[model samples]
Target: MATHAKLSPSSAVRWLSCPAAPLMERGKPNTANSYAAEGTAAHHLADQCLSFGYSPSDKVSKVLAVSSKGIGFFKHDQPNKKDIAFEYEVDQDMADYVQEYIDLIDNIMAAAKAEGFFEQALPLESITGEKGATGTADAVLITDKEIIVIDLKYGQGNQVDAERNPQLMMYGLAALNEFDVLAEIESVRLIISQPRRQHVSEWTISADELKAWGETVSNTAKLIDSLDETSDLTDLFAPSEDACRYCKASAECKAYAEHVHRTVCADFEDLDAPLTVDDAKYDGDTLAKMFERIGLIKEWIKAVEQATVDKLYAGESVGDFKLVQSRGGRRKWLDEEQAEATLKAMRLKVDDMYNKKLISPTDAEKLKKAGTLGDIQWNKLQDLIVKPAGNPTIAPGSDKREAIITNPVEMFDDLTEA
Candidate 1:
């Protein structure tokens, strides 16, 4: 935001949607979480793997680079996969995921070898996405005919698609600009490896198309620079679900407030009082509008609450609505160890108090704070993930999620059997 490309390629979806976000979020403190820290450690391990061409051994330190030897030993164990991971004690699923990355690179290289390009092709390199961007690409494979820019997403929070990915395109353009033989690289392939989701998506475009996209990135950078130096940003900002969801300026932005105001004010231009859904008379069109705007309205409300909390923490108050604790709520064990000890002393059946039943890998993944569910447990759960047919529901055709597939014959068989 300080005259830099704060609209980085990784955050292009956000800044592009809300042009003035870079300056609006200036001077905000970043709140780092354990997930981000774990991601960083994973990225460090991946970068080291790329650099050294080896995987860490089981003896690699476990304390997440808090120790000197942790980093040193991680670097030392290069190129093979006995115990290669971000954390020292990785889950089996995590091991498989890391191995997937390694296997993917190998597959690409092996394919290149089969096609006879491995000899002259430049080896894959971990690269900064672009000259002006503050992001790095996990790997880039360069050849005379094609350039493949790859990103590895370690977190399972959400699956990322490679199709028309601005992040990967920026990486491709950056890699293109870095290499001298740009003309030889005819096409670019963008790949996103989300091993946890088992979703590896790829998108491809001509080198000319990728170069044209670079113009967009350059323009975005310029726009950010202009916004950063602007006096008043009232007109420059625009708010939408994509832009406002992660913007640090949610609490202070006037544009978003105006958006909320317009949405509600227009909805109730004729109403004398707050109209409940039961009392409201709306057509299909109005109902659809409400449906679309409801999500955004909820988001705004949540952000407003957080902003209020932030101000309250600093000793500010909103009239008489000061923060307070309810007299009664759900209770918990004051001492978890003592509670467990008591349960053991009583000889209570563990299954009565604890869930001994199997849970889905997705559910089991919630227990993984820094690593996988540990050892072969997750791998065993992998076979148990029976993705049943999803219930059919109506949605707009424009929705990006894949439509559910069903077998007519199977349905007919069920009816006949019944």
Candidate 2:
């Protein structure tokens, strides 16, 4: 089966909305950063565990080269084959993340069976959605009357809501087309399992409604196909904070720049001049307005900074700023196994050389559930746990948490100290 990158379910939410991004990002370098490598490795690990029950050894070779400059693992004649060639190497941190993903799928399967949501046992692995429209779902549970699509997200950067998610909806659409179980799937269930943030978001829609959504996705794909390769699409941008955050061409994309600048200027136009509050204590209302715009502004600035670095690396200067390393790279032991052997020969206790291990609250909870820790022990362990209050965050007044208040004198004292 073949798939278009533009129609990929993972990128559907962004690309469908910002129709210009697909072409805009094409001209940029396809370099893999540390984060992308880690994510790829994590996904590969999850796939291995899900499909073949395989796990990597502690000293296994890295999947993606630390310095590889090519786009993905392979450059096949078929565009879809290019996606298959790339598999990331998993480090200990990535392995832990992969385990969380595995556990979530296991739980979802168990819940489906226990709740009698499925007629047969959960499939050994997820089934592909409509390749032409939605790409593939991570896991699919087909019941007598309903079909469930599950996705595992390892990144902790954002909490993705599963409600009316374009990607999942597309995945649902794809699943409906490919699978024809006995009961006839009447409803489509979408679940996004994000273990890093300890979130499992779920949403569902009728099969008819999902198919209706599929028509919209099909139309979007058709629109993408209809674009003239020689023509410019700078005016068709549907820009947003989430859409532009990870866009490779965000810095140079004219539509994105114009959209942000125009929106910001218009929103703040009626405000007092100078854009800065002259008062020692800014009013809550003014700060609230600033807060609404700050997040988007910060996202735009970060994208531009990264894009600037990428351009400079390719010998394209960003005005007066020249490219330079921020700091020297850290040195690592060339031979870790030999280093371990040498350390062992030196009579250094393992305890002295390695840090003490401690599991997180979530891990402890899992262990307790597995009966590794008895109820009494678990209670004692829970008693030892301490959770510090989170630092004050600036959020909308409509937030559920009580607004943190500060005394005027304390505020002044802090300002004087600054």
Candidate 3:
């Protein structure tokens, strides 16, 4: 059996849950993702500002300015400052979104202030578990009510939910032992703020519950260490096609290799065609035409598959069609001059009086309360318009899961060992 150091709680869960992911991680060695780098830089700056106490330094100001410009500021502290970078860029028209993020933090801070729970943010600590395993948390907010642990994620994906996150629970356990205020700790709140989507998710778990979860993490670490180095990856998780998309080891994994080979063979068969002696006479133009036809066929097949899936899931028809209710000819009403002349005789202008704000708010309210206006017409009068196109329905017969290969040993070995 190969004895390897127990992986971090986060990495262990990822490796076990998605076996192929580690292989994928190993394959991309030199890809310098700038967005990731920026995120890391921003997070580090935020951690320092919150932990060491905010200073008016250029670096701190720069980060705060950038964060203020985006949707929201995410808070978390992790080491390997060089490993992960926080790099989520907001769309150009994201002023409102960025303000919302600031508002969320402001609200939390306000609550903390009102409760007298304010303290230095993200106080650092080296937590030592059994067998000298150690890890650090990003930020720790102390309050009169409870301790708040905030984690900032710059990624766009929704992988972490506060309720199910083991890392947050682990941090709570570590804090309990380190601070010796486990009894004073009324509750541990886990906050995950995603700035890209302007989303915030929080989970509050009791200290007792977190302690139990910590024990589970420790036991799982021990079990993982007991596994032999040569143990088949499939023993951990069943191999499947969905694994291939994000698998680092897909290039070398035997299962993935076989699948790719089969796919290639099938494609080759599709390109094969019967040829006659005279077929060679006009080869160039014919070959070009064949390629064009193949491209169109591929597009059609994809569209059909998508439509089928949409129909199955959403129970809606799919295809191009013009609305039958659309008119073909122009229908004219009274001319502006004629209408105005007639209205003038009655001492009323033919202008839109409703748009002119001629009616008082009291009158509008009275009219609305009287129920004389039909629901649809009333809503329209109030400038409430229903969307012409409803929400899109997923096509029926669409494959929900893409093909995946579970075993990543081949790919991992190739990338790492090589």
Q: Which model is ahead, 2 or 3, in terms of lDDT?
A: 2
Rank order (by lDDT, best first) = 2, 1, 3
Candidate 1 Cα errors over 4 Å, as ranges? 1-5, 49-61, 65-90, 112-134, 155-159, 180-183, 227-232, 264-295, 324-385, 390-418
**lDDT tens digits by residue: candidate 2, 67-89:** 23333323234344434434554
Tens digit of per-residue lDDT, candidate 3, span 321-393: 3223546577654597786666677786447422465665445544564565566756666664333654543
Candidate number with greatest lDDT: 2
User: What would the TM-scores of all predictions be?
Assistant: 0.66, 0.70, 0.44
For candidate 3, the 10 contiguous residues with the lowest summed lDDT are 116-125
**Model 3, residue 72: what's the lDDT?**
30
Could you give candidate 1's per-residue lDDT for residues 311-418 as a string of tens digits?
Answer: 887898777778776698789999989999989899998777676666556557645523656647767767767778767865666546788878999999999999
Candidate 2 TM-score over all chains jointly: 0.70
Clashes of 3: 33
Off by over 4 Å in 2: 53-93, 114-134, 180-182, 229-235, 263-289, 327-379, 395-418
lDDT agreement of model 3 with the native: 0.49
